[model samples]
Target: MILVDSSVWIDYFKGVHNAQTEHLDALLDNPEEELAVADLVVFEVLRGFSSQRTKREAQTLLLTTQVVEIGGLDNALLATEHYRLLRQKGYTIASPIDVLLASYCITHGHDLLHRDADFDVMETLRGLRTWPH
Candidate 1:
């Protein structure tokens, strides 16, 4: 399964039409591709919608995919460890949330589809798989 990150989802909802969004669109079109959304990603995407209607629509769209629940003690500890490791490697992630997302993806063996640079860093340092692989 591929975890769709909020970065790509945001661009897709806005009809941004970039490579990442295009890739997401293609994935949505293909029945063989399994798509998922981490709970944090769902919150990140839905919370940004300005209107209730839009938020509901966004929720509906996200509901089509599997919702991966993260944030248990084990996952949080793993995320913290990954963050420390990245820091020791002279990398500073802007959001700890990204660490949690990456950790969840790593643990579940799900490839991520993201436009965020933080995920790229995670991919390099932690063996996080990315789509279009």
Candidate 2:
């Protein structure tokens, strides 16, 4: 299973292509792969479609993917811990939502599919694995 980040979904909705986001769509097309989205990702994606029809389409598209919410004592603690560790490693502390999303993906042992470099720090410093191709 893979935890998809908002960036990829946004780019896909906008029909933009990048290395990682393109790979993410391709990965999801594979029958063997399963896709998941965090609450943050869902919120981000919903904003892209203002028309009810498009939004409903978006909702239906998303329903095809599993919803994965991550906000618990363990997730909170890991976010805090990961924040400190990332800070200590000289990386800028990102938004709490990013931390929360990353924490969720990491804790669940799901490979993240994202184009932004923000996650690379987590993948490098934390043991967060991402889609390679």
Candidate 3:
């Protein structure tokens, strides 16, 4: 399964064209590819919208993908360890949510579809797999 991160989703929703969005578009076009959205990713994407109509539309679209819960004690612990590892390596992710989400993907063996640089850093240093692999 592929975990679609909020960074890609936000840009896709706003009609911003980019390589990641383009890849997401292609994946959406292919019925064979299994895509998932983390619950925290859903929250991150939805919280950015101000329009009720747009929010509802986004929610409806997001529901079409497999929704996966991104939290639990185990996930949190792994995320903490990953965060500490990164910090020790002199890299710091700005968002706790990103760290947690990356940990979820790493543990689940799901390739992440993201546009955030933090994920790239995680991929390089922490073995966080990403889409287009």
Candidate 4:
């Protein structure tokens, strides 16, 4: 399974042309491909919805995707270690949420599809597979 990050979705929704968006679109085109999204990802991506109705619509889209909550017992220790390791390397993750998601992907053996540099750095810290789209 692949965990999609906010960057590619943002670009796709805004009609931004890039190698990343094309890659994402191609993935979506495959009939058998499965896409994954966490609950926190919806908050990050759909915060732009201006009205309650729009927010609800965006939420509906998100609910159609899979939701995985990270950092219960098995992942928290790994996440903290990832946070410290990335910080030591001087790569800014910018949020605890990112760390949680990255850790989830790492522990679950899921590849991350993202253009964000944070995930790039997290790969080194967490040994998670990343698909830079």
For 1-133, candidate 3 gives per-residue lDDT tens digits of 9999999999999999999999999988899999999999999999999999999999999999999987888999999999999999999999999999999999988999999999999999999999998
Local distance difference test, each candidate: 0.91, 0.81, 0.95, 0.76
Reference-based TM-score of each model: 0.96, 0.88, 0.97, 0.82
RMSD from true fold, candidate 2? 1.7
Candidate with maximal lDDT? 3
Candidate 1: stretches off by over 4 Å: none
Error of 1 at 93 (Å): 1.2
lDDT measured at residue 97 in model 4 versus the true structure, 0 to 100: 70
Decreasing lDDT order of the candidates: 3, 1, 2, 4
- What TM-score would candidate 2 get against the native? 0.88
Model 3 error, position 40 (Å) = 0.4
What does the lDDT read for residue 82 in candidate 2?
Answer: 91
| Candidate 4: segments with Cα more than 4 A from true spot | 51-57, 71-73
- Residues 12-119 of candidate 4 have per-residue lDDT tens digits of 666798988787787767747676876677778888767788668657755665677774867778888888877787776887777888999988889888878887
Tell me which of candidates 1 and 4 scores higher on TM-score.
1
